[model samples]
Target chain A: MKSTEILNSLQVSLTIKRLCHQLIENHHNFSKSVLIGLQPNGIFLANRLKSNLEISIQDEVQTGSLDITFFRDDFRRKEKPLIPSVTNIDFSIENKKVILVDDVFFTGRTVRSALDAIMTFGRPLSVEFLTLIERRFVQNIPIKADYIGKSIDTIKEEKVSVLWKETNGKDQILLYSPT
Target chain B: MKELSTSHLLGIKDLTKNDIQIIFSTADSFKEVINRPIKKVPTLRDVTIANLFFENSTRTKLSFELAQKRLSADIINFSASSSSLNKGETLVDTANNILSMKVDMLIMRHPHSGAASFLANKTKTVIINAGDGTHEHPTQALLDTFSIREKLGSIKEKKVVLIGDIKHSRVALSNIFALQKLGAEVMVCGPTTLIPKYMSELGVKISHNIEKALKWCDVANMLRIQLERQQIQYFPSLREYTHQFQLNKTLLDKVDKPITILHPGPINRGVEITSEIADSEHSIILNQVENGVAVRMAIIYLLAGSINRV
Candidate 1:
């Protein structure tokens, strides 16, 4: 296996800051909008974005984590059972702008499932998605990221991994492929 | 990432501690889902489940049905009284007939022990035993233990006493298996005639005294006196049994330390426990019912996941 570094520690911090600024530009005070991080992989980036946004706007940012495990189309199709993460959106999302965040945007299945999962909380005004790493040309669904940190042209055999300082002891994004 | 070791939820005895923890954590997730503004998930929308109850039940039936609905699974309920069982159709025939309709899973409650096990061998669909004679009600035990862990923080090292008719109570047997597996000490306290002789052999202590039993434990689980299952008189009379074993406020007050109380209902209002005790802050009976849906959801969600094995 070959590993290629896509973004380094400095690049990750800058990209997150850039994403936060873009989010602030659109959502303004964020009172009418809530940032929801997809569970497991997306929560790390979500938490970082929340803290950064709060520091910039000098106000509380409503953020929650949503698990799409149960909502996934492959729920019972995998070789092993899909274990779910906690869905902790305590506040209702009724008619509020929802910015769904995740680490890597892959087959668009996660976003599709998230769309279904988020509806159970309540009907949102408009839902937009944000991702740090968007791999282009392989999306099986029509879903696309509204705010992207980086977009890379990739193939099916190669994998993009986003490592977090919060969980992985370092911040970086790496692309893996067979040599 | 974690699948149940077995595809079917037959009994607590067949589940490992990891399986129990998995179910508890999954139930915790479902617990949050059910409390949300819209109490539903689209997880099982593609799956279909048939609840086959060969015995009469109120709480278990409703709880299982509610859990199934919350998961958005297509559901069909079968009643023994209304079914072709009157013509002496075998349990397998009845199950196969239902499975023919492309039912993905089967949740059943039969009056005979090992009925789920028997059907599991005969069919390929996932099976969950709601209750099987005096054998085991796995989901009830899961919800009961879940409620205890919810109220007490943990089940480890907790002293839980099962009080009342142990011989005819499937909940008691499943509770003993589940509690002991999770590192909780269990004791059965009731009339000796109603308490089975096997209770002592199972490493569960037996006590004839309710006050001493209550005082000796951290949680007291009151089992309803099952009159329907009792063919012969297990004790002299209901009045005598109540006078001897019914738990009221006075009995609770004498215990010194407050012990959490659980009763798997259709609680006999005054026969096994008083209405005060049933409705008191010390009681988590309603929580047991509420958790039943979550736990059953976890059980069904875990078992119903993955159709290739079927």
Candidate 2:
């Protein structure tokens, strides 16, 4: 499939709307919950979720961003690594539930590192993962997302891409197979 | 590949080759930002940076403050004399209070060694060592290295002679580590009492006289004679020290090879170096001051972003 056509079929905005409804229904009892977005694209999605959730819940939600460049497990191979984005969660997460949001879930390494990076700040009551896309047969770790938009069966050599209107000038997901 | 997050920058010896390269490359980015029409960048906007200086400093403090402001970070200046510490509050208490204020980073200069490291352990905010009592000044060392690279093309195999008051100057100690790490041949020359005899243990050469040390050296770094050194009896008189250790026109004329002169300001002109030599063509003291802001901007930028992923 062409990149543009695959992206158009992804329906990220619709997936986000459905996920917000489900998250509110599941987490309604928690009063002091916060949402943390992984750096780059995850932060973009988290901000949208915060705005959408505010309309449904009638209360403000605290949002934070995390950069996992330094915390990555594989760091020896890259040349001139880019700086990570800002991580700004002002509230104490000690007893509050944290819903970690990201755009795509691949081998689960990013989410794994995010968990380790967040613990350095404070201990959250609990952390639940949410992602727009989940691929099949790629479980480097046993951890799974609590909220997944869609799970696609794919080969190991395929690449999954998420593009949003805020950053990439459109909302779409592209699956690229190695040549 | 990924960049390593160093917990603190306490000394040059603590940095690895990768760490030094990261610092230099980051400083290069800041150098580009400084040359633009609008010098400010939004990278550090809304980030609060605190400059806690327990020691008297004019130039270093000003350069740090300007660096933060140019990056659009909010700045809070706290001096020892007018601070709550003067009202009998402990250094830890003062630092805790500032950390309580939700400052993003703390750049400190104290009269005691390990003051910045102490603050780093007590708080979560990133701590930058501005200057600590005769211990190390990492940022100054970075700017000096940056200046040397800009002038000489490469620091590897270059000869650097650090002259005068080695024991009392933290800058000298920091330079010794920095130059050696960058592959420069470092030598310290001064009076026997002022120069630590065992500095050679750190892989540096020691010379009592400037004339022997200056031969074929690519750079001469003159350290200021701290006026307090006289009261402490490191030397008997300023006139005698100047006559013996000063870098003047006559000494510069005798050197067979062209050499760069460096001094961390504000200069004690006519004491360690003459006015004629300080303002001459070979002086990089002013370049060192100008690059001070860029080097510090790189440090604050990298450290602030190091916690998160882009």
Which candidate number has the best TM-score? 1
- lDDT per residue for candidate 2 within A138-166, as digits (tens), equals 97988899999878877787878887788
Question: What is the docking quality class of candidate 2?
Answer: incorrect
Q: Tens digit of lDDT per residue, candidate 2, span B1-310?
A: 2354485677787877677777777676566556544466655665788899899999899999989987778999999988778679988888889978988788999989888888788777778899888889989988998899989998999999999989988899889888988899999998888987679799888898888888858999989877663447777788988988999989878976678999998799899999999999999999999899988887786676643332
**10 residues in a row with least lDDT, candidate 2 chain B:** B301-310
lDDT of 1 at A16: 95
Model 2, runs deviating above 4 Å: A1-179, B1-5, B229-231, B307-310
lDDT string for model 1 (B227-278, tens) is 8988898888899999989999898888878999999988899999999989
Candidate that would win on lDDT: 1
The segments of candidate 1 whose C-alpha lies over 4 angstroms from its true place after superposition are: none
Fnat (0 to 1) per candidate: 0.85, 0.07
> DockQ of every model listed?
0.69, 0.04
